[model samples]
Target: MLTAQDDLIGHQTPAPFATSGAGDARFTERYWYTAHPIDGSELLFDAGLGYYPNKDVMDAFAGLTIGRRQYNFRASRRLGGRPLETSVGPFRIEIVEGMKRHRLTLVENPSGISFSLEFEASFPSAQEKQNYRERDGLVEEDLARVSQFGRWRGWIVVDGRRFNVEPAMWWGQRDRSWGLRSEMRTDETRPPVATHRNFFWTWSMFQFETSALSIFLKERSPGKPHYLSGTEFKRESDGSVSHREVVAVEHRIDWANDPLGQTIANGDLTFQFDRGAPRQVKMHGLPTRFYLKAGMYGGLQGWTHGDDRGDYYAAHDVWNLDDPATREVARTLSDHVIKLESAGDVGFGISEYGVATGYPLYEGPQKFPAL
Candidate 1:
């Protein structure tokens, strides 16, 4: 997630393009607790988080609040490109350092349980898809990337006490690219938020939405089809303001105990689906390992959401089906079939999965839009 840059340095302004030091980038997080069997297990506590300062730059996101009963969360690392901005009332925060922007936020409050959150957002600008094409947008070297700078940050979590929160944090990132909507030619920096030299793995699909909910993140990969999937949709609902759907697809993955946390899937050919309830559930375990984590000795952890997953903690970072990441390791098990389904009146779905043996500037197969 990198955007916003005019470029200068020796001239007068502009000199915030940051991020260097490839990736073995280690960042691990976990938060999961659900109970709607009667809102019993305490009331509510739902959370999600993930971060990878290596592999290409990654961040995460997920929402639901009210003190550990259904959903309540907070995660961080938005320093500043030196940037750090704050407000607090309704929330208007920003934090950037070494190329900022890769953040997430959600708040409802409705009173009652009270985990805190009324209304929030932190966007100093950070979004990427630089010159991609297909539907008519026209530029698609598969999907070009390079030229970065983005900033977003928001944080707060208390009551149960997990950890991390030095200055609240929102986010921001940079590599620089400001052509406005370039078709002309603009290249500043990017394409290296996470690079293990290069390996190729493509079989794409991942989309997101905001109205109520609409989710899909699929990739068959039986014979070979790795579009690296993710998606969530919701244009705007009037149907009494209720809409949700979810699907989880990931047949295998292994390698976790921290290092960066990589036990993506090991349910032995997986599938998970849902709708509504879990705060319109479309989650995959909610956190712990995202952006390809795995380290003990083999050393391998990954994350690089700049093609425009917008970068990490991973917005809605989901995929915690039944718990299985530590106690056994073997390349962090990633093999797929994960399915989670539900739609309307409350719809939701999830599939937090993966597998990799290649990426030399990894880019292949790319095609996603289950509309």
Candidate 2:
């Protein structure tokens, strides 16, 4: 079952490229990309392609939001036929220049949504340290990730309307990650737990004029941080790039009166450096919202990732974010397009935050802003 990828010099296992070292059904490799306008006028979207060697499945999903309408497209197929194919139904992703550039496309489908976008890296990628976690003697997460900030150039069509995306106005961030990411599964064979507390995590990458910032935070409890990292990639005047490590970070969030009390209405994040004074950035949520469920992360209507959808399956659905009744039912742990302001300089990125319980910020009265 050797494919063309077997001819390459990179080989991790003694078997063919199709074989994975881990026999766990949770092992996965994924390509995830998100893009939005700098000002976030109306459009924000994210797409992903995932491979599960143990499960012998590959799937691709796209979620797009225009104004208050959210459109989702998903497709899946059994692996092994086209061992190296990057396309699933109408969704396709091409690595035009490895880490430098990429082309993502979705042909015309019944969903009435299509796009052909090119992403060019603005700076070298930042490789984060290995992320490993275990609970009750079970290895839950073990993975490595590389992230980059870039700009998107192309166009997107929703239904009958067309929108032009220019590199100067459209910013994006992408990450290539692989390993045993067990959260992709819907069923878990673990010990029963009586109490379920909240889980708080945030991962964001913002690009400024001359530098980009990447932040990752995971809390064990209300005030105890299990993992934290802050990195700044600075571009010098001579075109050289450098990275600096942050010493600490503080989250000052004003929570929204949502069902879960996890939404951030308005807030600021202060990042402390080793030597220079700390930097504080104001954060504002854009009008467009994109959730992970639409991409099959947390499952949409019971369609979770790695599920056996037979040889080929494609589906589409739409939701109106403006409708309060629909919003409560469709609301999940989601990502928001964020506008960043520091010292009057403007930047933008996506903020992914999930809060369940044990979060200290949600203890007091929350301000219910117009959602």
Per-model TM-score versus the true fold? 0.24, 0.91
lDDT of 1 by residue, 1-371 (tens): 23232243332323222322222232222111111111111112222222222323222223332221222122233422311222211223233242333232334322211222221222122222333225366432232222121112223443334322222221111222222121211111322222221222222211122332222222333423233222223444553322223344433333233342233222222323355334222222323222122111121122222222321121212223233342122233221112222333321112333333332111221111011
Question: By TM-score, how accurate is candidate 2?
Answer: 0.91
Clashes of each: 131, 1
Candidate 1: C-alpha RMSD to true structure equals 20.6
Point out where model 2 deviates above 4 Å: 184-198, 221-223, 258-261, 274-276, 364-371
For model 2 the local lDDT of residue 20 reads: 77
Candidate 1 residue runs with Cα over 4 Å from true position: 1-89, 99-133, 136-223, 226-250, 253-371
Q: Evaluate model 1: give its TM-score.
A: 0.24
Model 2 lDDT tens row, 1-371: 67777888988877877777457788888999998987648788789999987788999988788887889899999886585888898999999999999999999999898999999999888887788999899898898888899999998988888889899999999999888885633212232312334556678888888888988887756446778777888899889998877667877777666563246677788888767777888888765678666777655566778888999999988877767755544544466888889888888888877554555555542222111
